[model samples]
Target chain A: MSSAAQGLRRTGSARRQPARPAWRERPKPATQAAKAVALAAVVLLVTVPFLIIVSTSFASNAEVVANGGWVLWPQHPTLNAYRELFDGGIVTHALWVSAGVTVIGTAASLACTIGLAYALSRRDVFGGKPILLLILFTFLFPPGMIPGFLLIKGLHLLNSYGSLVAPVLVNVFNLVVLRGFFQSVPEELYEAARLDGAGEWLILRRIVLPLSKAALAVVGLFYAVSYWNAWFYASIYLDSDHWPLQQVLRTYVVGGSQLADSAAGDASAVAAPQTIQMAVLVVATVPILLVYPFLQKYFTKGVLTGAVKS
Target chain B: MAIAERDATGRTGAAGASGADRRAGRKGRGTRLTRLRRDWVLLALMAPGVAYFLVFHYGALAGNVIAFKDYVPFDGLWASQWVGLDNFQKMFGDPDFWSAVLNTVWIALLQLVFFFPVPIALAMLLHSLTRDSVRKFVQSVAYLPHFLSWVIVVAVFQQVLGETGLLNNVLGDAHLHTVDVIGNPGAFKPLVIAEVIWKDCGWGTIIFLAALTQVDEQQYEAAAIDGAGPWRRFWHITLPSVRPIIVLLLIMRLGDILSVGFEQMLLQRASVGPDAAEVIDTFVYYKGLVGGDYGYAAAAGLFKGVVGAALVFAANKVAHRLGEQGVYR
Candidate 1:
């Protein structure tokens, strides 16, 4: 989000068009106010609910119950819900599972995508055309859900972390984006690298990867986000003990399962189910929030580079 | 956030760079062996991704043959008994299947009517803002929800609109009639659409905003010079500029219309009952996975896949007729 703003600041001075050009007149005060109100409504529609979720997650149990399950402003904010969640129970176990999947899955996905994208971007590699065509064909007509589930079963991937990552190891969209970004590197650079005795792998590591940091970051973030957010396959393939955070949270929060056993002890140890649910929601949300600012700066540059150049 | 464009032909990506050189550089049959030997490293680099597609995509695709089989737990995919269209006959005659189809089509049409044009309008609104900071802030906030999982989004909505949720609480205080939304059958379609709007409308604007930026300032200036008002200027310049992309997206949406949010519906299906919320994807899940009717469910899924692929092919043909790039050439 801030990435676009940073792009604006970086290019604002060099921008050719003025805010109000000579041929255009400024709008009336009423119009400006209406526009402001509209923009504010858009922002509020997004933010207010999020603010309430975060606030209710920290509110004391009594206050949350009194507020009828959604606390706007927590007068007595407490960390008891989060405390109970992390008391070595299901939420804690699932959190580690999600983290483990995210780290391993993102790394594997990025590595495979980089290799394939780089190979496809180059000219006249043997079998590259056929391979690229075959992959792109699958994008048009994806494999069906039942067959996909059956495959996982046949492969004995049921209830394993491998089921989460192996089946979706390389996303075609990310591959195409990286491929487009790689192709944008001038051929002259490749020639110069070759003259200096650089092999393909070395060229990739030293030249292509360094130059394509923006795109790489964007793709990496995408892989990470998808892995973290994934639960559908987890629901189908994994047992409850092996489930990821999102899947477990789905049962407790959306499925409205009992919260007393979600943690280690009796009912008194946990906060209100409402607050515990909100806490789980916040835990599921925080990683994305933590990671967004760093890579979001590349959104415009990375996306446009692929789209325009390809 | 992806834009409207799809790279259907990888050849076009390389077309601009090494079109002639590739033909000349790696010529006839003699050097083909040499070229293969030389390019082994590149092929080695591609092995993991290539193997992934082979095993997961095509492997699963081949597994679709079960649609014609009576699947047994002990008997594998190839070993299953060939029932030969029996599953399809059963699926076609099922009233539940037709009802699911109806629900899918009705929900997709609602999305087309409500969820389609939001981003375009939001993009235009964001574009018209002269204050760069405000525009950036709004874009950032609006796009935040798209990152959330369906589980979380559904939970948030339930928290806001469930029987004991915040909306009812506020209404109770104000002594007004409270609207029941989350699990209500009549409100399901609108609730789903609203969830979609909250999550994706902001992210969808990125493509249109990119298109809006590409509109030459001179065109807007020229329209203003011609004494056109803001609305007329938008009609003449802005709308025309984004129309191509809008058409491209609509065609693409048509291709994907049947597949609604499966996990989303699955999460809330028990609360509202299948009559109100069952679509093809969730129906496949419940029938095949939960209910243990593998062959019949695979048939339903195969039917959906074939129709969806046909729609894409037809949509692409229409795109070519319109002289625009579709999902493929």
Candidate 2:
């Protein structure tokens, strides 16, 4: 009856239509070949730097420096950088901390976010409206940094790992996307669950979540990426010893530090500093590279549909 | 348009509220309360989320009180003496503060001018690709950088372009003079912008790509029938179809002018120095938390926050005036 409600109805229908344009037809074989070449060129441009980083990471220091600070393909590629990184040093400790934080943080964040989003998605759920408003209000007026830090401090979370996880447990954008997805599930499914004497939790676990896998994968990947990449909170809250890989990378690469402890090597080992730095870059970026392919299938449609409706 | 509908709904809800008010004094004055009492199980499930917001968000909001206080660690916030307007005065008079503001505006403007069109162009290019597999593969590669941390991105740039890095190494082999890009004060802004484009332009394509999907196939077919060339069809059909999304994103970007990537600048600040790298965010961090000048930093931060909010509000209002759908209803 309400226009906002009407718009919501229209949006759902619009999504279902898949509106193929009549004028647009499949391309000719020649055009398709041309398109493939252009696309490959774009992909090549994006991939080259990453390839350079990876290659240089494995390259010998002499080879790296001799080739004008590049090692397109290492003459004598070695696992020495990785060997040094994992051998009980600052980067080793940082690597462990980053892994722990990402795993623990992503799980906690995904759970809390899904719980809140699902509750809000249900129109019949009691206290949902006020709760939704409370959550949404935070989007409009985010807390200032000082207050956030102070609150973390007051909770005695400072210098602790919990500070990194607690402050950003639920991203509002992710919550909205997840909620939009849950809302799109057919109402008949919920009714059928109720008829079968299934409770909300059971329905959520068996029915809702199963159906929303694509969305969950996308949102989960988003959470994982953000958590892995995060350094600001860790920089402010944790001691330097407890710093994550990104923060460690920040100190070494951006701060331009050349002290070889173990990650790059001892000062006497003698390697190209740029190569060592590139090695660190690869180490930091590898997690994202690992998770991308699995989620790439759902990304475009999942992200676009979720974002546009909001 | 959405707001007009919302207003009508709210007006009707308001009318319904008076009827509920009249019934409230009768037999079921406490019915809603009774309903709430029955919903305790649901409340238990919702408690963590509610508590999370109460502490992290609202508690932090209450922490803004430190903006008026001296904020000594031992004394704590409640015990600190209020120093009204001193911080604001100091912030206004600081030359570094002014430079940070100017730098922020300049970078944001550059992003608006140069960086903004990248995603649109990228989406167009992707949209034009005839083969779906080729288009998707390109997209995956383009989106890769967005996943990297700022630390990694900066590191990548340094390795490729720093004085003794790959570019220099290669140039030396060819007997060419090295050109500095990374950490150079003159090149800092452009480098930062370039880094942003590399990392985010593809991600930005998400919205434009979505818009492109909405363009009617019939329109393109009609243009082809009219003997229009590919370029003419693109200009007539595709660009206009995606115009609204572009306008909407531009307005949103304008509102975020004060924030030109705090972490990225902070990481690079030592090399480029504050003169070139300082933005409002770094300025606030240095003034308040890092320098132990809480009140002044808060003032600077508060100023940025207010201005950002005002910009969003103004932009949204302008969008509404132009008969466009803004970010919110």
- Runs in model 1 deviating more than 4 A are A1-13, A16-18, A262-270, A302-305, A308-310, B1-30
Q: After superposing candidate 2, which stretches have Cα over 4 Å from the reference?
A: A1-41, A262-273, A308-310, B1-30
lDDT of 2 by residue, B1-329 (tens): 23222323333344344433342212242566775664455566567777899889988877877777777878997998898877778778999999999999999999998999988988888877544445566777888888888888887788778887767877877898989997789999999998898889887876667566656565777788888877899889888867777767767787888888998899889888899999999988887779887766777877887788788889988988887778776
**Candidate 2, CAPRI quality class derived from DockQ:** acceptable
Worst 10-residue lDDT window for candidate 2 chain A reads A1-10
Let me know the TM-score candidate 2 reaches against the reference structure: 0.88
Top candidate by TM-score: 1
Task: In model 2, state the lDDT of residue A21.
Answer: 40
Give lDDT tens digits, candidate 2, residues A69-88: 77787878887767666667
Interface RMSD of each: 3.8, 7.1
- Sorted into a CAPRI-style docking class, model 1 comes out as medium
Which candidate wins on lDDT?
Answer: 1
- CA displacement after TM-score superposition, residue A18 of candidate 1 (Å): 6.5
Interface RMSD of 2: 7.1
